[model samples]
Target: MADITDAEHHIVAASYHLMKALQTTKLMSSDVRGILEKLDFHLSTVVKINEDEPDGDSIRELEKSVVSSHETITSLHLSYSKVWASGPEVILEYLEAVGEVQRSIEALEGMPLSRMSNGVLEQAKTTLHMAMERLQNELIHILVQNKQCFEHEYPVFEVYPIYEESVISNEDDSVEDASLKGRSSSETEDCAMDLIHPDVVPQIKSIADTMFAAGYAQEFCLPFTAFWKDVLAEYSMILYVEQLSIEDVKRMEWKHLNSRIRKWRVAMTRIIGVYLGSAKRLFDQVLGEYDQVSIACLIEASRGPLFCLLNFGQAVLIGPHEPEWLFCLLDMYEVLADLVPDLDTLFSQETESLIRIDFHELLSQLGESVRVILKELGNRIATCTSTTPFQNGGIHPLTKYVANYILCFAEYEDTLPLLLQDQEPVRESGDEEQNMDGEADPNPACALAMYLQSLTSILEAALDEKSSLYRDSSLKHIFLMNNFHYTVEKIKNSKISPYFGDDWIRKHYVKLRQHAMYYQRTTWSSLLTFLHDDGKVGKATLKARCQHFNTAFEDLYKSQTRWVVPDPQLREDVRILASKTVIQPYRNFVRKISDSIGEKHIKYTEQELGVYIMDLLEGSSKSLSHSRKR
Candidate 1:
């Protein structure tokens, strides 16, 4: 026991030390076990040395001697984690150190350790291989077992599409090649995540259809949600393929798509006996169901195939999107168009014409009913927020928008009516015989947009708390700031207004924006002063001051994007405006500022302010964008 200084002495003696530790209530060295009162500094050093080494016989022998050392270590880690969690830098460093040791074990095992110089070395190598293999298997098992956990968490994305990477719009071949210049492995790994590959839609569809025919039960809704996990897992190898980029999803084979569309098209023409499939007697119930279904349809319409329908229905109807579902939506409109006559048919002529009544009012009443649902949604957000936001994580923004709307505004039952309609094809007065086109009733999307802006403005004005959200705040601080704005926005926009003007929501948005900007500029100056000078806060704290404002701006981007009723893309243009105007240049500013943070770069305020303006315009920051395109 001559001072376990040599590597072999520390490793070999660890086994006996563990054996001694297991026999006593308190851990003790083998020789000192009989003397009940002394500290075992030698034993602690041995264990520390063991934890750092590649997995080997010495560590396992020590672990086996100690009945519950693994559990004890976990407990110790947990007890101290709050302190480590507070400092992300330390936590990351700790994980990295642990990971490096594990990586070394893996590399050692891969070599011809079977032919190591000594019997102990060969045994240690074999033991390490077994441990690594077991760990990998355990990870796979856990992921498979918890497949439904992800679904339950991200239900909003059940029908929408998810892109693994941001779509790279860069078409320059020179930049594409040169972009790999002077980049580190970590940067390359990050870039690898952005590549999107074409989906095997035809194969998935064929397999699903065959499986269903072979009596396989459908466990989930939507093709993507059901198959996405395994699909993503299997294709994960694509992430490791250097220089090979998986591109965006390409169009499905027209041969397969057209056959299916043609089948549905014929069925629809024959099945379309009435206006809304079969909503003759219970028009009210049918309308309600339609509202739910359309909302679901809109969820689909926001991504993948549905995105094409909403965005490019006229151009690629026969091939990618097809005209049938579009026709179905159109026919659903006809059913509503028939509502006026159907009411007359059911009752006497004196009954209030469901036709002459304002469509907006009917839709507004429906929207009001849906608003009551938001309370439950808010509670859920409060509960599972770390894992899932108000809208689930990885879910499409529009999907979350729909879920949050339903959750928060449960009372405002019918929002879809404000979005869709069916009316008589009225042409030039005398020649109203063939072509069917009518004037826009009120443009509910316009109204929804207005309400979102107004609501966001209200939050900005009330909270006039931060100058920039991302810089000065932790995610927790940013979340608090964002949540405050969220509550105000949901309250204002999700519910309908009593004021009966056509553009009431629009007016609300305008007023809210004006008041918000004024209040933010006026109040934030004082807040900056309060946070900066009085408390002697660090640069990080000062940087956090900007987080609230960044959050507000994100909410603003979401509001403006989702506000447009019939034309959601019109709102999407605002994102383009936000990017071109604020983000790109400020991002460059952040790179410079971030470099000089600890060593007194440019002023923290300038960087904080710049980052705030930039982050707001770019993120999926608000609760969820509803009333607009995804």
Candidate 2:
């Protein structure tokens, strides 16, 4: 039994040792597998890294290409640093060399800098930088050399007819013809002169493209913009655009200022519409691929001169408001308004939006200034008064001035409405009554019309006030008649007639007639009372009436001879009306008193009275005095 137990223990110990051996072998195999898997992963990663890197031979070839391009660029830059002065063939070679260098630099940038020796990479960059610098200088030189000069002493602006005669056959002619004919000569077409010489534009574009591709756009623009700005300044000088400050404009005398303002209008139109337009075309041609850069350069180059032009307008805006400035201000407003679309198109780039905003702000300011000046003109007309009566009871100077002034406004009818669009129409005292039955016309032209009507009404009111200056009621009526008649005739004959309308003309005509009637009643109605036969039953009373009538008629003739009527038709009408009022009655008085008071008692006969009345209102006091002597 002891021997069997020893055998079982030995078997158990052997089994335990076998299990420990198996466990140790399994652990060793697992460690070896993990190490092999890690090695495989590292191998794959190394392969991928190697795949991404250029081969040694490829790197050497790229290096050779870079070295060759660098040598070529260096040679070209040294040879053609003043490429603008070189021939086309040399320029082409230089541009080709620059292009080759640009491609090499791009390739070098794509590869790892570690692959290229630091020296090679630095040399390539330096060569490209120097080449771009030369190219920039060349571009500026080309632009300056190729700039076209104004050939004419005065800038000649051509105006083409808006409507083609082919479009307007006699059969198709209608009210449209009138409107088309009414277009101002100022509504002109653009005649863009070449700002840059046509021969060198492609060369400039090539240099610009190369510099832009080389990441030297800023360097390219710097010199290009600087040179062109001076060119534009010279062009402005040629256009007679003086860079006057606001204070300088303010200090100028009006006569000199007026001439300058005229020149300014012509210069601004030429600069913005023609010269700037040509510049824009040049930029579009040269930098067509880089629109933003082109626009930025244009704005930078032109902003100074453009602002100088606007400064003149600003000076005019803040200057003293004078009635005479209206036409020039209107001209400025029209030109600015017309250029808005051009400005919107030229400065459409996001980088150039500020310039567009400035132009629009100036336009708004100009429009506002125009409105204020118009209001000032109306105020001037309204407040222009004289304490003393105008001599001779003839048409007052204010009447003639206001009449002719408003007549001039009709020529600007198309432009005035645009400037006055936001303004409320000025109304006279009775305009409300006149327009109460009808809705106001919303047409823009009507706005100007309403304002013009108000001016006429103000003129009439001023004349009414001036009439009171005459001490004699008859003379007062005569003065009102003369002024109103003159005003009516002026309106009736001018383009201003359409603004006031037929009703306005008729209303004023009736007012003038009322004044004429009033004059007759005041001057002659009292004399008519002397002709009435009250039964006094005495030759003495009859002779007394005859004598009174004779003396009063002669006195009326003498006093009225100096009162002048400027219109021939109006003078004839007044004389005929005066004859109808007084001639017949005096004839009856003379016939009745002829038997009682003979020719001796009667100082004048009907025929003689007729001759004197025919001479009324002729403005010839000497002729009437000579007739009285005869």
Q: Which one wins on TM-score?
A: 2
List model 2 lDDT by residue over 1-630, tens digit each.
012244554564565455444555554654454343333322222222222344544554555665566556555555554876778887777777777767766765666655333434455576678778777767777777777886436634343211111111212212221111122334366677888889888888888888888898888778887887888888888878878888898898866776677667777777777777888888888876785788888888888878888878888888866665666677677778888877777776653376677677778887777788789877877777676787778877677666766766776788887667578766655564334558665668778787887788787888888788889898898888888888788788987788788998898889989988998899889889888865555888887887677677767777788788878888888889999998898888777767775667776667888888887776656333334321
Give per-candidate clash totals: 44, 0
- What TM-score number comes out for model 1? 0.20
State each model's CA lDDT, in order. Answer: 0.31, 0.70
Runs of candidate 1 with Cα error greater than 4 angstroms are: 1-400, 403-503, 510-630
